[model samples]
Target: MNRPTYNLLWRLAMPLVLARLWWRGLRESGYRKHWNERRGHYGARGAGWHTLWIHAVSVGETRAAEPLVDALMALYPNSRILMTHMTPTGRAAGHELFARHGDRFVQSYLPYDTVSKLTRFMRHFTPRICILMETEVWPNLIAVCKTRGITVALVNARLSERSLRRAGRFGRLMTQAAAQLSLVAAQTERDASRISSLGAPRVVITGNIKFDVAVPAAALARGRFLRQRINADADGDSGGAGRPVLLCASTREGEEALILDAFKAMPERPPGMLLLLVPRHPQRFDEVANLAGLRGLRVARRSTLGQDGADLDSAVEVLVGDTMGEMVAYYAACDCAFIGGSLLPLGGQNLIEACAVGKPVLIGAHTFNFAVASDEAVAAGAAVRVVDAAAMLAQARQLLLDTMTRNSMGAAAFGFAAAHRGATTRTVELLQGLIY
Candidate 1:
């Protein structure tokens, strides 16, 4: 727990640390206005109330917190919910929390997990409890929160082999931080064991909160509007058969290259085969467009597809979903999905979006982060996992070539997503014990 050693150790981890800093730099530049507005909440502002500060780091975490946040408001009607996120994408998505739940909650960019920023943020919120979503654990954040007599819990907690091994190297440092957690409500039993090994408090199996999300009725109607906007036929075909669209969601950088290669080599690229590539981050929309263009395929822009959601484009391949908050529409419109980030070392993208709609989902072997949910889907025949791009291409080709197979896989996936539902209730029960 020595500061000097920890700083030196983190310095050795410069590559990852710098990568994060570089990412924040891009956010600052690309989303200046958005960042400025949200960044204002970094200091102590909502003090002197019963506050439960929740950290949903990015889009996935933010989306996953919908049900839990709802429960928090239910248990403590007067208690203010302050949600913090570090990324612009996260901040934007977190705003949805406010939109859906009302003034009981507010979203802000989390202060840096350093002591000064941590102190400032803590003093501002003066939270009675801190519930960290998923696997995020910042040392100074935990230490400061613990010192403030805040009851801290890690909700929907997961621990992969990679994270476990990495945290293992910093045994005392991680243990001291993790030990501060008052309760550890994990997503999987495996996650509990991993955290326990790292000296986390006895972790309770609370299940995954992503399953608890309330898929908006507005989103469903909007998805149809988006499909019509893109001119996707009622039958789920792109105007003139190119190859049935593979609407990819949440794809990151390096994975695009692999996906492109697989798409390029398809022996009989289906009629109306459009790859609507939506990068995970808005800042990387341009970056991903460049990568997809380098593949020498005709590309389309979603913004240009239709003027209004009610209009129709009906003819555009490779529509880049570079806009903010339109995932539900694209996921509904696509015939199936290739959920990226899994093909490379990025640890997979969300399959729930596709699964919700019963679209056949394909992910690669790099799904360490969501291994619990991913495995459940695969076991139930709701999702398919390939070892690499080669296998991924083969699976995609097979699924695209055969409608029955695709339909069956999608059916299984819908079943899987449905059965694994209700984490929000369990999570709410846990928080009610404290916040209520």
Candidate 2:
């Protein structure tokens, strides 16, 4: 449909959206807490100041924006930040991550893509410029920003082949929305081509911002501590060596089942081995934990563990990572990481964190969401791709069993990450042109 019709339909779906939020609130109470912000009711926080608005829809995008956010804060010390998110998890993550910024780092839910609400939000924030993290191409929002002469840029932008094909359905609207963007700092050559084809006037390949994320030393120490605790427990009285840890990071809905099936069918289920399963969404923590139990695997909840409760019993096959903001720790603790979302056509989750921690990564066939980076990592010998559940199991098994290969891959992963670290700087330079 056209832009006006799209807006009309979106406006008509307001009740449904609110209902969905209410339903989500039942599971994650953060949704229930930010009602006014969702309606564009943010009051005079940056009232007469130059507010630099950034929209990071959910947790992943919010995390990915961290490096860029750091650069922005350094460059524009006096300018206030108005962070907007669509998910409560994203908002909470922003608060947790940028807590030191205090009032200068404001956060709210981005309003529904309705003209009235967006106009209200625009008026409230009165931002000098807007930076969308990735893949949030709202026609209404872009059009409004353009009409108001507010510069808009899409940083760390990535347009997958699947996404571009889908956007083709709403050709005119997509093109119009793209045209409204002043600049797009795409993550790769493919993304730049796709976004330019969709009608962005200026598109530059700035590389992926995620490459710039720094893993905290504290996180690494905590991970090592956790691993030691689990090792001590799994080793028992046998004085046997601890089993290698396999981290299934950010596994999505069908992915957990696939992974568990692969684990069950392993030709060699190494003794004392532990699988750390971290679901992508917080709401699915219990569901994933239950899924593991249903698969007949002995499960331990990360949330329930005390500081010293790292010693896992040999019987415990899987540890449910029910906590948030500890991905680095998980990566640090693991011998090999299977970056989830790739196993079952969900377009794969980010593997940068795994690389950042120098862990060998195994991703599934469908990494369209991160196509270029995955391919680059594989070419760099930093990561390996598996076709499906069975292949993942086999590859993970090899990596776990073969320490030398794993270490080599891990070194490559770290090297690849280090080599790709200048994206944030280039993006910040691009933003400088727009703001200054």
Candidate 3:
């Protein structure tokens, strides 16, 4: 215990401390209460089990693992599963997926990585094999699992160049922690070699699981219903976009400025260009609305836009579809989409959503979160990666002018997504191997 303390003591203490400082920030947030409730109650009934534990952080990772989780459930019918997450969005998404398993799939908030909390979590789940998505390595989490002799694997693992450089500056504790994983199923060869440089062993290239995103029939049906409600064709199915519906979705804090700039700069802004700007976080919705107002664009809440059909096409009412759980409908109606969270310092967003719906996808080169997806999409001609606001405007304008390129890109995008549909199978295979 005296040898460097594995750094978990500090890691576990920081969150509780930050939670105290930002108690006000999370005070009005329903998610805070929801996560705490799940941590305290849901999935706590069965404390001990031989479970296949999978941990994902939030909405993105949870969705990325959806296909794999379904595959695992079908492939290993007898295996009980434990799914864990830190954030409320992740907990909600996990619950939606895992709840149907009843006694089989249990979802919970991951306990803090304190010795005691980790001990409790381990005792409760008793997972023989731990599957972690992306970069979810805590020193205590890994060291304790190693101490307990539970096999652990990293799936769809990626170590960003920026993250690696930051780890180097921080004395590489993160890298050291990651090395304790038994196997690393990396998203790319570059990621594999880089993590190996950071001391991870036996890294294998498995491709990204997000590529295996399955279009739910229910989601498609729901999208159709919503599209009909909006006076857009419910069954158009991305063939011959009846109109120019531009969905500026999943924008992070800094990305909106670039989007707004491009929108305002468009000479004779293409007719029927209905912009739906959805920020990445719920808290920022009003902030982004205010920013849009400052840009001299009339803003309309999508809810309000539906209620009142005034200014459906005008300098007023850029529809704000600011609600969660409706992204599928939003994506389906969007003729083309600008996947945000990338234009500035935020890296990038899930361009996969647009691509999944066969909406011609646009992105800024700043995406580090889904690097392989972005790269593969661009390589497959399913996406256009731009450098800045100016470049984004240029690319978007070009697409607007050239319907043929947009249609071809949309087809290629769908092809790229459909072609990489085997991660769920690969993941299922490994998971079955674990349980059996």
Q: Give all TM-scores, in the order shown.
A: 0.89, 0.96, 0.88
Q: Which candidate is the best by lDDT?
A: 2
Top-down lDDT ranking: 2, 1, 3
User: After superposition, which runs of candidate 1 have C-alpha atoms over 4 Å from their true positions?
Assistant: 7-44, 235-243, 308-315
- What is candidate 2's local distance difference test score? 0.86
- Give the alpha carbon lDDT tens digit for every residue of 1-436 in model 2: 7977897888788889899989989999988987987787765554677789999999999998888888888889898788999988898889988878876788888888877888888887789999999899898898889878899999999999999989999979999899889899999999999999988999999999999988889988778766776773221111247767889999989888988888887878666678889999999999998988898888998887656654667688889999988989888888889999998888998999899888999998989999989999999999998889889888878877777788899999999999998999999998999995
Best TM-score among the predictions, by candidate number: 2
Question: How good is model 2 by TM-score?
Answer: 0.96
Each model's lDDT = 0.76, 0.86, 0.73
For residues 1-436, what per-residue lDDT tens digits would candidate 1 score against the true structure?
5656765665576567546666777555634433432323443356767778899888888888888877778778788788888776788787855666676677667765556557767777778888899888988778887787787889999989899999878768788988888888898898989999888865789888787666677877766666666555555544334236677788887877777777777776666566778888787787777776887766667766656435434344467888877787777777778787887787887788778877888888888888888888888998888887767767766777787888788788778888888878887777777663
Which ten contiguous residues of candidate 3 have the minimum total lDDT? 34-43
lDDT of 3 at 24: 41
Residue 324 miss distance in model 1 (angstroms): 2.1
